[model samples]
Target chain A: MSLDKEKIKHVAKLARISVDEAKVASLTKDLNSIFKFIEQLNELNTDKVEPLTSILNQSLRSRKDEISDGKIREKILQNSPKKNEEFFVVPKVVE
Target chain B: MSNITNLSLSEILKSIKSKKISSLELTQAYIKNIENAKKLNAFVTTTFDQALENAKKFDNKPNNEQLLSGVPLAVKDLFCTENVKTTAGSNILNNFIPSYESTVTKNLWNNGAFLLGKLNCDEFAMGSSNETSFFGNVINPVGDHLVPGGSSGGSSSALAADLTPATIGTDTGGSIRQPASFTGTVGFKPTYGLCSRWGIVAFASSLDQAGPMTKTVNDCSIMLEAMSGFDDKDSTSINKKKETYSKNLKDNIKGLKIGIPKEYRVDNMPKEIDELWEKGKKILKDLGAQLIDISLPHTKYALPTYYIVAPAEASSNLARYDGVRYGYRSQKGKDLIEMYENTRSEGFGDEVKRRILIGTYVLSSGYYDAYYLKAQKVRQLIKKDFDDSFTKVDAILTPSTPSSAFKIGEKTNDPVSMYLNDIFTVPVNLAGLPALSLPAGLDKKGYPLGLQLIGKALDEQKILNIGYAFEKNCGYKNEIKKWWS
Candidate 1:
């Protein structure tokens, strides 16, 4: 089943993307086409097939468990659209 | 100085060696081009002054044999560079300057590469057409009205327009190849994980790959060599030792096996590209390479599989842009939720928002097993298609795109048509294999067709060798369409 206009609005709510009322209709159509495409996946017999992560048919590499990332907080915060001294700034949340 | 604008790196090196032009003068010429072509939207931002200033820092400017020593290459806006705006062509990242450099960009700078500017790209590399870019679409140098293809449209357009020598672009699902085909240039997406993705903005993590768009296959190799290497910072990065791209330039293709997937000749595809593929096979066969009929039976499922897998990952990846952190925020909103909604809705282009919705719905709690996990299994089937074919052939050959470049806004209104353009190229990315799009021939419509070569994992050199040989026999020149001129 495809996402209805109501469910799409709910998903937009979840994703934090505001949908214009007019766009909702078109979004509903596009989302349905995609869902139909994805619906084809249901036809595949995957009862026994293992989900593959990398296409090379290999396992992921694991390194020594250690915390090694160094201090670069200042450089990182420089690109923040809005920042408050050491932290990223945003609209006030607390009362 | 031998048209400093479009000269290959080798040609530039020769001029620099002969002292015919100083590195600073060459940088200035490119700077001039960038200034003149800024209206093309080829570059998002140009640090020309900083680049020249860096050129002046070199001790023996002309005497250095730094592969790309003085060449100014444009980077797609996705790669993070310290203090530079890395927007991924979306308003959400409109002011999100990264704090550090991506390993690829850092490697280029370490090799004394002049960072001329960041090229434009589709918003989060999501759209197949450049139309979704927040900075306005990149104008195809060939036809201002026709698309240059996307999401790496700017890189291909930049290279074609001679505004920049070459540019680095990421390919998730034909982003690099389709644009390269459309622009009539070379676009190579090395095996996934060959180039470090550290500090690059995420789209679909598993499929996002950094590669080059340039005038020739050799330039693609030279640029790819500089861009690729292992980095621990990117967990998906391969630990394989770096291979020399230039070492086997003259490799012969006498006994090379080129597979043509049977399902790729689907009836819905444009007949013009199909005709061009026929000619491509004749040329390769005439050149002594054996063309074999191979079955990649799961090819029909590639597009749907990619849509499911890519959007599923895109939804998760784009979730980070919730306005509370580092990106666009709403001017006036009541609560944090409202701010996040307003910011993203206003910040992302329509295509992005559409994908996000699809991604969210598929990966939702109750729907995950039905959509995301099932799609993962389909993805394996798609990979198996290539895996089974590689057993019979050294590499796979097909049209990079079903047709040549379409006009801007042609398919933008219809999402499925836009997705159809990637039919020929998306499978390789889903399988994490190396592939390249080089100039094959032109369609009857006067647009270019690209012959694609898909190689086994980390077998980029093999694909490049095939491309090098194809160019040798076919003698396909970079025939810039008359519309742009």
Candidate 2:
């Protein structure tokens, strides 16, 4: 149940968080402790129990598919870290 | 004028309507109080000038019809305020401002409350103590070195210190109530979806609920009235006519059945907290209510279930924060993937990064059924426990926290110990029920201890009324000395 340094690095990569090699030992220790704490859930018998999908137990409300509001692309892009001409600028994705 | 800041929201409304005080005068008084109390580090962003401008506008064209009536209030930084920098107490969003307002803040403004500022919180509302805030940890005004409970720590601290007339905070687990209990204020978490989550920085979407942290239960009722409603934007919002909690608030709970959940009496609970629970039961009994012993067998599993479910959802919700959209961007990355990794690692604090990692680990392909799905089933059992108890009693009562506030840095290194702070409060969130915490008495250290009243889904008025009765009879008042100023 304990995560090793390799697993910690793999999870970090999946989470898109960078973990330095120097810190992996401590991360492994911390994540292992948290996982150990979470292991107590294994004692419960939930074999026949249904997973809870919603708190209110109601169907999701839906609205008609129509254009509700638009025409303010500038406001939408106002908080972008890098943007030009109605699109956010990221490191070039295309090969 | 010196005592103007001490008035509650309802009192402030009365004063403004009767011409006994102008909105400008009240706002100035609060501004002075906030300025004098800078050592507490309760506020991340203070919009004093804008607050004063709004106050003056209210004074010029008086509106007595509004619920808040020009009261200047601060909210947890997790709420997105239009054009205001909403950091959610993380460095990644340190410079990010929302193009639109959150539905909760918008509702408050529509009911005539204006923003005083954004208060500090645990980063992304993750940690139990405010120590996780990237800006800085908020000091509880109750004592010099004591930590304000988080992630709504700043809201409770600010309200207790009279920095704002009243305030609002979101509770994913014990964020609002635990801080309120620590600071000797009143905090209420309404049923899930009672308050819209649109524009709120999501933590655990199913469990996160915004509620009031006020100086009195009456004020809590008033603030709740102004905040709760349905929004078309949030699909989960409860589409029902809003109840008038303030007007219906009554101290008479005669013939009401209250449940005393035996399972909440955790091992090694402080003597003072146990006594406080006993005292709360007695007060309710003296008020003509009947008490029944109840059991929620699955109570002990709430924390572990919460850890799994909250992180799993948080991992998915937070995936949107990759360097593509708004927020912090890395200057060190050579490629897109590296950019996201570098930006998130550098921008998020240690606690946030830890939760993200745990979330990512639990929801990974091989472990999803063992961790995430199992936790969800356990969560259903946790909810069922409450549902069975509610069928036997009108409301449930328990200690708000295991003990009083701890010193800053005391539990910072131990994440499990920090998670234990929300034991009693987390189950209510798991079940999506309403609960309120009011100061029952102070512990031996003169720190405040609170008693919680749990209610059925969407039954906020019931808990508020019970809290109203308890506050009237308990005779406990927070005698916080303004030593910070």
Which of the numbered candidates is closest to the native, going by highest DockQ?
Answer: 2
Q: Spell out the clash pairs found in candidate 1.
A: A16-B341, B142-B484
What clash pairs does model 2 have? Answer: none
Proportion of native contacts kept per candidate = 0.68, 0.82
Which lDDT value does model 2 have at B360? Answer: 89
Please give, for residues B1-485, the per-residue lDDT of candidate 2 as tens digits.
56977777888788889999998999999889999999999999999889999999999998889899888999999999998999999999998999999999999999998999999999999988799999999999999899989999899899999999899999999899999999999999999999999989999999999999998999999999999999999999999999999999999999999999999999999988989999999999999999999999999999999999998889888888876678988888888999999999989998888888989888999999999999999999999999999999999999999989999999988888899999999999999999999999999999999989999998888899999999999999879999987
- How much is B91 displaced in model 2, in angstroms? 0.5
Q: How high is the TM-score of chain B in model 1?
A: 0.97
The CA lDDT at A85 in model 1 is 88
Q: Tell me the TM-score of chain B in each candidate.
A: 0.97, 0.99
CA deviation > 4 Å runs, candidate 1: A92-95, B59-63, B481-485
In candidate 2, the second chain superimposes onto the true chain B with a TM-score of 0.99
Name the lDDT value of residue B357 in candidate 1: 83
The CA lDDT of each predicted structure is 0.83, 0.92
